[model samples]
Target: MTTEITARDKLLLYVVGMFAFIFFFVQFMLIPALSASDQAAADLAVAQQAQIAMQDTIALSGTNAAAKTESWAALQQANASYYGLLSSSDLDTLVSNLELGHNLAPLSLEISSINTQSLTGYAASDKAEDTAAPGEIDSSDPTLATADTNAVLMELAPPLTRVYASADYFKACTVTFRCTGSDSDFYTMLDDLAGQYPSVQLRSVQIDHAAYTDASGTTTGTATFTVQLSVILCDKESVAS
Candidate 1:
């Protein structure tokens, strides 16, 4: 006996075929496309980071160039203002200029000393002293130990020493002078001197006053001014050559 196909069987076969096609389409096309998209996003992120780093490096280089230019300009200005080594001829000129044109009491100019200390060694010694401990009292001498007394109070403070450059390259000449006169005249002389030599470095100033009391208890005084200054010295001929 032969069996006949039914409409229900045909419809069932079509539904199963449709489900298999849908499954294969998702596995072969949709899944692979999604994976490719994720990989492309990761690659884009890495490229963006690299670009940002390059931009930062370029900016930093520009900043450093600007700083170097500024430093060079400052060095040139300083060199132009500096005076060279002192000489006998220069000394004579300096004295003549001060005495002839200016009006004040009799003043004298003298060279106090020349300092040629190493900057590195001086700074190291200062650091060592700062880190050292205080010394104990001395039993042998009637007075306190020099170290103990010098450690803090009851000791005179040393003058501030400014280090400009290496001892091998430069020397400092200390010039000191005294000016005595009425207060008005004294200050006017100083102002004029400063105006003439604007680059001179004034180190210290000391003033002394002498007053006399008369029968009526009135007092009159004249002031004396001591001024110390520093002049930088170098071998200008050698440097120029």
Candidate 2:
């Protein structure tokens, strides 16, 4: 048996198929394209807002000769201080040298133990000035507060330059020494070490003294001193790069 479809029916079928295809295309492809276009427009708007904010910041900055000089001087001092740090690679050498040099002391000197903590752990407090307060050893971190030129530029410098610099940009080291030495020899060592390495700061010194009465009825004592030392260190990442 054979059945033939009329041209009118064929035309109707063709029209319906075309409409269904158009609906599916709109649902699957066109909607997603429209949504992506909207997201792109929103992202562009946000970027433009950020750009405008940065331009405003630049516009507000004014140039002054005196301010410029002061800022430049501070910058120079900071850079010098940064370069003065001990290279991380030589940390062992420094410890060994400290121990070896101690043997040359006029009095008995020996290192009993050593302990260290990274300065990166401590928050940078805007504390500094070359002066150590009267027995203020217990009051503050002397290592962080003394002869730290770069730390000032980074952490405590005037607000004018702080935005351009970071308080924690520079890396540093902290170490503690448990040692035995006579009072005179210990103080002498501290003073000399400070002079030799302006970059090194003495954080604290604790001494335990044991007094004994000799047969001559004279008293003698042995002082065990604990000294803490800290110094700037070359930025590990910067060197590796």
Candidate 3:
């Protein structure tokens, strides 16, 4: 059978087709394109944020490194100064100079003892007695001389009664000596020792002066003065080794 077509009907069919095409274009193409553009913008923003965070981390690391370097340099300088003082030979030379300078005195000056006792041992004793009797010897052996000296020194210089070294490079020892002279002679000896020896620190000093009449019955002259002195020895080789 053959069907009849009208112009109105044909125009109506064309309008319906145009409306369907417009709906599909907006839903499938335009809407998807807009969504994809929004997603891309979000990803770009995240990447920029990550880049900024990375830059901040790098800057902090640089600052920390510089601070560490400066601290290390300061520590090195301090170490150098400490080592220089420890290695100096001035202290050793001072001892000899003091001896020479005081040798001219008419009074007798003698180092009776030198002691290298352990700090621990000295502390262990219940009663710390540093001075020996005037004529009594703790031991007849010469090896005990150092201990005796240290004892006398402990009595003289209470501040340095006990000493310890921070490292093996530093050596500490004590010296004990007896001096018999007039008041003037004793003063001269002390002055010369201090002036000549920078390292010879006087730890202890004891002066025993007694009045006695001379053969002429004159009480004008000083009869006798007995002194005990404590000396410290610091040598570079002893410390460096």
Candidate 4:
């Protein structure tokens, strides 16, 4: 006996096959495509974040550069304000001013000593240069001959205009002095110096006291104070009124 499928069975088979195909496509192909799209979006977000971070870093670098320039300008300004103090020639002027200030101060001061130095490590370079004989080499210094030769070459070298040429731009001047007085008097002297010279900066201050008994058995003591000041030194070209 031969048997054949009816039309209803064939239609049911067609519908079942369609449903299976749809299920497999969604499970294997469509779902994975959607997952891939989500992953791509996440990666794009991360890339954008990285780009923003780089931009921020660039901005910070520029800001730091500008800040450095401003700091350098401030240094120059400070140096200009101390043009007088930096000069060995100005030593007499300093003493004269101090003498005048002492007379005007509220207390009497006993000034023991006053000294000046260069911030460039060599305190009395100018004095040494003046005292050295022509073509003389300091045998104590191995590099002295080379240094002197370089100095002569530099002096003879033609001046080339440069945007940032400076003579020892990082250098400054230092002044130190010792005085004997009471603490209040010391403060008064400090105030006087600060008032008279705007560029004078107090670097260090120390006080020493000595106590003694006289014939009357009265207790008395004296205080000695030491003070140091710093002032920036600039090239003559940068000097301003």
Best by TM-score: 1
Candidate 3 lDDT, 1-241, residue by residue in tens: 9877799989999999999999999999999999999999999999999999999989899897777566545644433332122212443343334444554222444443334434333233213454432223333444433455455434433333233332111233444444444566567877866675444445566666566778989775443434444343433222220
Cα shift from native, residue 93, model 1 (Å)? 3.0
lDDT of model 4, residue 13: 100
User: Which residue pairs in candidate 2 collide?
Assistant: none
Decide which is better by TM-score, 3 or 4. 4
Candidate 3 Cα misplacement greater than 4 A, ranges: 1-100, 103-169, 223-241
The candidate maximizing lDDT is 1
Error of 2 at 81 (Å): 4.4
Alpha-carbon deviation at 184 in model 2, angstroms? 1.5
TM-score of each: 0.42, 0.38, 0.33, 0.37
Q: Model 2's lDDT to the true fold?
A: 0.56
Give the C-alpha lDDT of model 4. 0.55
lDDT, candidate 2, 1-241, per-residue tens? 8888999989999999999999998999999999999999999999999999988866765544456567766655644544334544465456546645664222232332222222323333224443442223332555444336545444334442333244434444666556665777667777778777655667676788889899999998777766666665443223210
Residue pairs with backbone atoms closer than 3 Å in model 1 (clashes): none
Compared to the true structure, candidate 4 yields what TM-score?
Answer: 0.37
Q: Give stretches of model 2 more than 4 Å off.
A: 1-78, 81-89, 102-168, 211-221, 234-241
- List lDDT for all candidates, in order: 0.57, 0.56, 0.49, 0.55
